[model samples]
Target: MKQLAIAASILGLLACSPQGEAKLSAAPEGFDDSYLQKMGFTVETVEASAIEGVYQVITDQGLIYVADGGKMLIGGRIYDITGAQPVNLSENAIRQMRQKDVAAIDGEAIVYQAEDEKYVVTVFTDPTCGYCRQLHNDLQSYLDKGISIHYLAWPRTGLQGSSYEQLKTVWCSDDPKAALTAAKSDKRLPAARCDDPVDAHFALGNKFGVRGTPAMVLPSGELIPGLVPADRLLNTIKQSQ
Candidate 1:
């Protein structure tokens, strides 16, 4: 369903609730999220928000907020405007989520290290993406600038189909780095199988808010979507830090 329509449905429910209905405990230790499930959203975590009576929820669709005992949903970022520049509380939450998830990949991702690494960036890539290949082909530019790149699989076509299968073949190969290089070059890779992390990588990409290939997550947990040049990436990281 469209997000706006879903929101309207939830709001309609909120309007129909009996007056003086007891609210869900601020501490929802045993919270029920069946309403969200009915709405087709898989709930991951539910925690009290910084605001009273509002709760923060982590779901497959990213972070969301709810109230009125989880029946009413509110969307959009929460900003703290007390500072000279407005601080995006939601971005902070998402960034921390990205950091933990990106780090969890460990050595699973195909890594290109620099001799004198100053920054490490994780990139969600799809072999079929021309820009993804361009980024891979120009790795030396990033490496030469003391930036190591870690590549995690993200099939733009999703978790099924040829793109997904091809990435799995690359991850399953005895030499993943070589296979990845070959895949980007449009060369046929020998069919292989293993306990691949491609699906896990794909899930992580979704949680990391990647809508396309060549999504880069810097060490500072900032997400830059799309193809970024080596020098520009370095400058971006420098500025963020």
Candidate 2:
């Protein structure tokens, strides 16, 4: 995993007013604004943490925390230990982020709509992944349960070689749905090209921390990292609702 360095510049964030008490209206009082740039993130939002003096920093890549007047930088999930049971606040925030990202899609996916759709989920998949192939094979099971799937290509090898070309062909074919199914079954698609959204889809998957294919983003914005059985997935979606 690529770890982001959140050292010196985070102190400036910590020194600012508490997350809820004040919004981060400006950059830290004395820290170089370039720290965020160096870290390859732009400030998506800055809010207060459950812990005093710590600020929750929501970035494009994910969430992080800063505390002790920039002396401490914490990455990964944060739990609210105040209640009877610990609450994963960081995961909650990430879910909201994922929901927003998925909702922002503007018809860039190859959709397998359920005739009597009761639920919908966004999927990031690669034709070459075994689990992705399995999911493709079982797509109808989901549809049978009124679960619509929106498929977005995230070719793991990126836009450089065979995998990329295969996925692009799938996207560019006259019948994208059939092409996807064939490709996942290891059938060769005729060479095709167009202004496909494959790259954009991959970029979004990367931003969402997708390390593997067949990543499903539920209606609630929670991500399931691998293949989930159709019935179980339906139950999971219902439980979420």
Predicted structure with the largest TM-score when compared to the true one: 1
How would you encode candidate 2's per-residue C-alpha lDDT over 42-108 as one tens digit per residue?
A: 5556666777777776554456676654445565567889899998987787788778877787487
Candidate lDDT (C-alpha), each? 0.80, 0.73
Candidate 2 wrongly placed segments (more than 4 Å): 1-33, 67-72
TM-scores for all predictions: 0.86, 0.79
Clashes of 1: 0
54-167 in candidate 1: lDDT tens per residue?
Answer: 888876556778887777778677888999999898878877767876787767989999999989999999999999989988999999999999999989888788889999
Q: Output the lDDT of residue 72, model 1.
A: 76
Candidate 1 at 148: error in angstroms?
1.1
Error of 1 at 100 (Å): 0.9
Report the alpha-carbon TM-score of model 1 versus the true structure.
Answer: 0.86
Please name the candidate that would achieve the greatest lDDT relative to the true structure.
1
Runs in model 1 lying further than 4 Å from the true structure: 1-27
